[model samples]
Target: MNKDHYTYRVTWSPEDKEYIGLCAEFPSLSWLASTSQKALAGIQNVVAEAVNDMEANGEPVPVAFADRHYSGEFRVRIPPHVHRALAVESAEQGISLNRLASAKLAG
Candidate 1:
């Protein structure tokens, strides 16, 4: 959420049968998935993995949006049942739902 960083939109495309993810400002880093949530999850996982891999290999992580900016928000709508479960689990762990989701996905 840095002001100088860029944000990407990950969306579902039924025609492609996959989630379509791409940075509006960085077109080269695009990916796809089968659902909107999955696409968002995939992009986060892929980006984190890529960063970790680069760090492991002693390579500099790419910074395509060092000075770029974003104004829109990204939304990933989960089912009501799933949201309830996440809320319960997050409370049990004493963490916010967003933190819980991020930790689960990062793992």
Candidate 2:
């Protein structure tokens, strides 16, 4: 496993009443479950699926996650349109856009 591939963080959500999982390195891969343990298990399955799919398609698997966890931060500049969309989403979900964005980025 490469040490610089990608990492993710799983968080618990009260409104949704589930444990949400996300991987920023794999932006499209995420899952949720009723419990943290279940959510982590689900994440493992999701990762396996992603790896299997990538292998079947002859794509390189992202093995960095196996080496170390991500623990750094950076900044991004979102367009106004995207910011508005995120704000609307945050309002509808009853969560702060900052939290949502943090979760998304941590993933």
Candidate 3:
């Protein structure tokens, strides 16, 4: 697994007063540093070490989000009242429910 392909995010932590680095694939692991660059590097190194240990233990490695395929279709359940309102709104706008929902989500 290419650790570089894993989704990494760096954000400022007001409480910690430092930049926090996070890996989506390894939610339990994190690194913090005074600088965003250092925080990112720290998290990447941590993820690399974790991957090495997991490999040595013959564990299945997580597939990076960048390496995974996504289907456009997904199912969502809404309250009946909300569903009826959406249906009415779609009709008022002369659009399909899926189109209205997609537009709302994208917005």
Best candidate according to TM-score: 3
Give me candidate 3's TM-score against the actual structure. Answer: 0.94
lDDT of each: 0.71, 0.77, 0.97
> Given candidate 1, what's the lDDT at residue 55?
80
Model 2: lDDT of residue 17: 82
Stretch of 10 with least lDDT, candidate 2: 1-10
List candidate 3 stretches off by more than 4 Å.
none
Model 2: lDDT equals 0.77
List pairs with backbone clashes in candidate 2. Answer: 23-107, 24-107
Clashes of 1: 3
- Off by more than 4 A, model 2: 1-6, 63-107
Model 1, CA-based lDDT: 0.71
Error of 2 at 40 (Å): 0.6
Candidates ranked by lDDT: 3, 2, 1
Better candidate by lDDT, 2 or 3: 3
Best by lDDT: 3
